[model samples]
Target: MTDSAASPIDRPSFGIALILVGMLAISINDMLIKQLSGGYPLHQMVFTRSAIGIAFGLVIVQFEGGWQILKTRRPGLHAFRGLLVVIANMSYFAALAVLPLADATALFFAAPLFITLMSIPVLKEKVGPFRLGAVLVGFIGVVIMQRPWASPEDLGVSRLVLVLPVVSAITYAGMQIMTRKLGMSSKPSALAVYIQTMFLLVAGLFWIFAGDGRFAEGTDNESLIFLLRAWVWPEGVDLWLFIGLGFNSAAVAYCLSAAYRSADAAIIAPFEYTGLLLAVFWGWAIWGEIPGLEVKIGIVLIMGSGLFVFLRERQRNRPLASDPPRGTGATRR
Candidate 1:
């Protein structure tokens, strides 16, 4: 018998395998950003990622059908989304520099709460007290994680480092709200393409004026002037830098989008957070980065409460979820 025929379990196995690999890919991509951010400009790093992301988006559009998606016309919300990305990318990248990937990502998990809150004003969707309480509970976890007014949990604090996670939560939450509103008029392919395109354009423009459009200063260090002769472009081997980022990102996009389609939000939604565990492991191994007890405790609380919030929301929305596809990254449409 053929292998496929012999191993009937292989059908579902492929999906499970892809999901696992995708999480790893995303974690590694974040690791790359953290490593590169030490030297590269945040604007330039985002520019390069956006440039690469759009290329990937183009390939996807071609596979799906091209100009049809390109033909979309919602310049206003599209522009607004570009602005939101400025906040998301900068805040998230800045947070990644010091915060463990897991911590930064946990803060991102609060994006759903942001979504729920913004829906009233932007989407005009009314949320009852139950969902509102869930949002509050989720934010309580966020505050616990933030540990404002000082907590016994903090290992050490410069104050700035501790606050970034909370800021990341708010910014990412804003990003989700923007995506959801924009998705109403934008095609998935179109939305992805435009966001990347706009970010690339905006960051590129900023870099041009900031550093004469070269994306590298004299030594290429824009993050600080302290590192003399700091900037250096990739050699032959380093060109693979962008390629590596692109591959991991594409894999993440595919897996995450597919996961949402395959199962319920509560079931698979929490699965994406698996990237955080991998992040913690890799961070310790590669960077010797160890978060404090409070951060570690906060990670548990943030993820646990976030998952609880998702589950609670699912229970409330359960009746409507009859074969309903879970949230793909683009909640806009």
Candidate 2:
């Protein structure tokens, strides 16, 4: 059997460590993006960050096994995965421009639940009644956080704006599914390069279409403004922040890929929750944002249900969260 085909049981501890590091990097990256959202367009930030990330990712690719390792037979799937990631990043960051950081992060955590549901159709995985119920409970948590019955004034933002993270989560789950399929043939660094390249291309297109800020005129909607605002040449500290985002993106992509590649997703997936705590910290420390009672309750339910789903998958010995294709050798390069 190839190294990649070897059982994940061999390096589970290392996988957990990698996931924790990835979550920390992600939390920092999110906080930085949110901080800059008021002054920068989402696509501009994505462009800057992706450009730097591609540079770093190329270096990683060289260390893994030179430029040839970047080649893949599944170009279409890679492109689709890249598109999914772009959508996920755009939706989530646009929400960050207006919503509280912790709230956005919590809502996006529903991706695990979405993955469980999507697996039934996408991966042809059978989820038993218990996991199905967990999925339902998780959605309930989502509804509670949304509080659709409340007015926009009371909730502090439009209900429509709140949906962005959920949209991001769904697309993110789809991206993970694609990653599982692609993992068999691609190295994590190569995958990161593909994603960064996509970000660069899409961001460039956004610049061509809307970077002039003409579309942002007369819009009071904060999210729309974040999306349509004109790109300004970042100066001084803002320039440094944008540069930092590139490093963070490179770290996040590679660490997460390596984490999942190293072990069973079930064993390491729960560690991904570390981001929630980091989100809470960053939110409070930087913006004085705290989760209200309703949000706290929603977070509890969503987290509980998501964890239960992972546990159930583990017990059943099914790989719903991320079942990489079988019989492929490790493409560590």
Candidate 3:
């Protein structure tokens, strides 16, 4: 008999290994982005990340033999996925500008809640009371984090901070749904290639046009300075970090995919909240920023809701409390 290692199927050990390593890389990537955000233009970081990601995807495609492994028959659906990339990155990066990585990620963790609701309407999937309750609790967590209804002064809400991630979360949830639907027939590598290529194309065009417009329309001397030079060029070390960012992003995709192959997604899902922990630590270490109690409570509530959903989902997938699920759901990595 052929060795199990030589089989086409990935072993349980293989997938879990991929997941742990991937999460570590993703954590490092998030920390890098948080550090890089302050001095560099958020859009510039967006530009490089998408660009480098495309380059990496292209390498993957070529190795798998040209566009055959990369192209999907569904152009429109692929484009929609591409748009989600634009929206989610813009929103998350915008949030990174002011919010600590931990705080912002805590808010973004609500995607599963959104996805659970979205599945009902879009995919016509049925959700039980448990999941619904989880969603409600997640919303309460969101309200605490955002304080969206409060007066601007009371909340310190700003243009980019509050609006960006709300939309980013919705788009990210859409992206997940698209991946699931596409997974029915489409190749994951193809989907990754499409997302990367289309995202870079669109974001590059945005920088070419929108950025130039903003520069031309920039009113103050400070704004003009941003337009003229300072924002374009961060230090050399920061530029190299963008390559690490690309690898980190790729690691997240690969890790989550591998992890899911081994165990139940719901069971693994709660681990995603660990990113909040990493983000918090990074925030303090890099910026000396301490979140207020409100932020801490928000993280706890959000993380709690996610953990509940994950456990509930795992129970459903495995159909037994004693039985472990067969897929993992390690988020962001």
Candidate 4:
């Protein structure tokens, strides 16, 4: 499929609204996952959530264009994209088990910066020096949040665990770039089904290997425990929360895929910062996790740099572009 065969009209405003909604849903999903981290293993939660998500995604498929829309000439790309999402989710959620919601979210917001940098090499787009500098400032924010100079006890998190969200950000950047590529030829609902299915497959593999919790024994690492812990049957409110995750996952996948597919990524990417605000609010209200002065400064720098990049891209009228795939259409802005 070609760009002309996909969406001919780019609706950036609509994309922004969708991304805001997606970010909101994502924040709620993170809170639920964190709340359940103590009692449930990550794979089990992923399994339950994905199973439910697949059911919802299939329903979306019917509304989209039926099961036919799910057929693609790019199965390999979809598979690769799914793997990237699974990696991104596992790493970020693992960090959530050990870090404050605000802190983990702040670190993960580095995805926009990674997206900007990756655009140059991966998409063959040109980035100006000013935008490059903004990327640098964003890294400084990540460093301040990490606080390498502080001891583990002083920081209240092991430095080793700090790497997880960064890993998540990098893989997520890669995944979103693929989303842009795949979005040119696929429906958002179809893209979402691929992701949910991947999550289910990975969760099943984890169940087969580590669901017994044998590997988690004698380990005090909270992040590892979250990954390797035995699966317990969820009861009462916990079951409802798991069900909620399914709805959240389906919403997030569709909204984000549609948002990126509909506009220049630079145009809508900054809207994702909304998640940070939601995370901070949820952290304080639910877990009593408050951002320190340094964390506040770091967040400011990160968000500031990202907004600057967005403004610069808009000012230059230089949205990232991919090589045209055979057929001609309106050039993406």
Task: Return the top candidate by lDDT.
Answer: 2
Please identify model 3 stretches exceeding 4 Å from their true place: 1-13, 62-67, 148-151, 182-188, 213-231, 261-264, 318-333
C-alpha local distance difference test of each model: 0.58, 0.82, 0.61, 0.81
Clashes of 3: 7
Least accurate 10 contiguous residues by lDDT in model 1: 1-10
Model 1 TM-score, 2 decimals = 0.75
Encode model 1's per-residue lDDT on 219-329: one tens digit a residue: 422323211212346557556886777666555655654444444445555565677688788888988878666557766766665566567667777511111223224
Q: Where's the lowest-lDDT run of ten residues in candidate 2?
A: 324-333
Better of 3 and 4 by TM-score: 4
TM-score of each: 0.75, 0.93, 0.81, 0.92
Clash statistics: count for each candidate: 3, 1, 7, 0
Give the local distance difference test score of model 2: 0.82
Residues 155-273 of candidate 4 have per-residue lDDT tens digits of 87778789999999989777766655544456777778888888999999999999999999999999999999999999999999999998988888888767866776657766878
Select the stronger candidate by TM-score from 2 and 4: 2
RMSD of model 3 against the true structure: 5.5
RMSD of each: 7.5, 3.3, 5.5, 3.9
Q: Write one digit per residue (lDDT tens) for candidate 3, span 297-324.
A: 8788878877787687666663312111
Per-residue lDDT value at 51 in model 2: 97
- Flag clash pairs in model 4: none
